[model samples]
Target: MKTRKIRILIHVAVLGLLIASCSAEDGATGPIGPAGPQGEQGTAGADGADGADGADGADGEQGDQGDTGTANVIYSDWIDSEFDANITDPAAGIDLDAPGLTQEIIDQGTVLVYGRNIVLPSNEIFPLPQIISNDNHGFRVNSPENIRLTISSLNGAAVGSRVIEDYRYILIPGGQPAGGTTIVIGSKASKQEIPDYSKMSYQEIMEFFGIEE
Candidate 1:
């Protein structure tokens, strides 16, 4: 009987152990542990690269120059023929009735060159002799002495067609004025003396004409 009791006690102990183990396995799992603490923030990243520049627009084309301006006196084939009188012959007095001797006509194809001024009456039409050859003649500006005006003929042509066969030259003479500032006047054959501008410098003439320094 004592041996039987001992066996029963051992079985009871083993049963208790098994029950404890089973209880532990059956219990519900605890809530998941809280998430780990957040890590420290990293340093800020570098800025992004800049975008490429836009292409430039095409350049505009240049504009053309304006037309040439018109002048008061323009010489061309359309105008009347030009002719001047030749009264240089002291033998014959001033003759105004000479044929084809007009008061004034802008003679073309002729160039009247002075100190720095090229008085090419681009409007005058040339006759047979477009120029006159006059030497020892004097000129004045505003009737002033010491002032000079020079002239030169471009082509050779007779002053008149009939008896008065004087070849009128287009060459105007040069001279200097003594006082006032102005261009000379009167004909080459005029008995009046012309101003002698030969003594004056080019700058003086330009100044007289009110030209820039």
Candidate 2:
């Protein structure tokens, strides 16, 4: 038969080229990879926002002045005394009619006026004894009814029953005698503020203060 059918087709074409050269080639090269364990830190990247404000400065200057002070005073020396002339008020007389009095509190001392032919108000307060004798050296006028004496004896003259020509006096102001010898007032206080014996004539009031004889 034609050469045994061409030797069985060349033994089935060399067994199909040995099953296509034993299933062909793609697959070889893998040994370099051992450096990788530090990769779990990839989750930290989120924060940044805020900034704006600045401008203002100017004004300063003024200071100076201080100096001036001094004070000193002196008057040291003067004194002498004698007492017993603070008598008034055998009854309520003298009243200045609402004027408490102020010569800086009547010059703080001595104010003796007894009303006789009046004339004192400027040295407004000091030696004011127009007259009030009994020679106890008399001095009375402080805190009475302040002017309201409905005459007791203008024509007959009296001390105890108000009206020696409408009364007047003064002894207050620590009541006399802090020191003496200043008793010589205005022309002996206008010739002894009346009392040549109420303007004399009882024989010139027994010859002016010589009392009797």
lDDT, residue 91, candidate 2: 32
Model 2 deviation from the true structure expressed as Cα RMSD, one decimal place: 27.6
lDDT of 1 by residue, 1-213 (tens): 999999999999999998888785788898899899999999999999988655677445555543322222221112111223442232222211222222232121111112111134432222321223432222222221112232232233322311222222222222322334443355443334433333345344334334332
TM-score of each: 0.19, 0.20
lDDT of 2: 0.34
User: What's the CA error at residue 125 for candidate 1, in Å?
Assistant: 36
lDDT of 2 at 68: 15
What's the true lDDT of residue 10 in model 2? 96
Residue 85 Cα positional deviation in candidate 2, in Å, after optimal superposition: 27
